[model samples]
Target: MSIKVIVADDQEIARTGLRMILDAQEGIEVIGEAGDGGRAVELAQRLRPDVCLFDIRMPRVDGIQATRSLAGPGVADPIAVVVITTFDLDEYVYAALQAGARGFLLKDAGPALLSQAVRAAAGGDALIAPSITARLLSAFAGAGRSAPPAQPVEALTGREEQILAAVARGRTNSEIAEEFHISLSTVKSHIASLMTKLGVRNRVEIAMWAYETNRVRT
Candidate 1:
């Protein structure tokens, strides 16, 4: 089945461009579009698309707030959100990430990457823009915090440690599998174990834990 998506941006031209790019891809479809954040939230709750593409700045409401409303920590049922923006600013990216967005992309990331990011979010993976990934995550790891990350109740095995580092460095599960000469299932097993031990929801949170503990430094 095609991955269903909702595009939310204040600009008609931007929404049109994104819809055109996504609609042209096989196995991907733009199911809806919203011109502002309030409508975006309403449509997302009603449609519950596979992925939501939101621009950061909008009238009446903003993308971050919309993201938070749909996928924030307090949400009972969180929808996957991929924040699309014209700006590459770290602060905006950080806020979006903290708001529980599954991925981030600059508007010019192009069709291939744009599609990849949508698929990644739908598949429970993350795809932050590489131009700002490391710097933004590293700084976010330490910013406005005075305490260390919660230590895992169970100790990390060597393999799990390796997986954590790889994820922290922005390596995908497929890449980690290849790097360790392990099967995809084994890689996922290690990732699952890591998530359980670290008490994280996904790879992004695992990466944050790694950075918070200085396992992967900038």
Candidate 2:
């Protein structure tokens, strides 16, 4: 089945480019396009695409707000959102992540990465642009808030701890599986267990928790 996607960007060219790239992929489809955030939300609710590709800046509404409405903490049924933006600022990345975006990508992140990100989001995984991943996550981890003395993780086994550390380092599930000489399904099982143990919604949140809890070596 094709992964249905909605492309929302104020720029016609950007939307067109994204549609072209996504549509050319075998297992992905560009189901809709919205020139503004308001319409993006409306279309998202109506069409219920597998993933929403949103640009940060838009007229009438903005991508972050749209993301919040569709996937924020308060949402009852959150849709996966992949924020696509021209900027790579940490603030933008942080805000989008806070708004519950499943993935983040710069406009020039290329067709391969863009497609990979969409697939990742649709598959209940998350990806952040590498250029901003470590810096933004680390900054968020160390940004002025007092770290908790330690996060209680007696539930996690040694293998789960290793997987969590790899996730915090931005390693993909496949990479983690290869690194640990485990199957991909085993990596996913460990991640699922880690999330349950750590009380995180997604891999991004798990990474944040690892950093904030001082679980990852800086």
| Local distance difference test scores for all models | 0.86, 0.84
Candidate 1 per-residue C-alpha lDDT over 66-171 given as tens digits, one digit per residue, 9 for 90 to 100: 9999988889988999998886664676677778888788899999989988988888777776665676778777664667778997999988999998887777
How far is each candidate from the true structure, as Cα RMSD in Å?
1.7, 2.2
> What TM-score would candidate 2 get against the native?
0.89
Q: For residue 110, give model 2's deviation from the true position in Å.
A: 0.5
lDDT of model 2 at residue 49? 94
Candidate 1 achieves a global lDDT of 0.86
Query: In candidate 1, what residue range of length 10 has the lowest lDDT sum?
Result: 87-96
lDDT of 2: 0.84
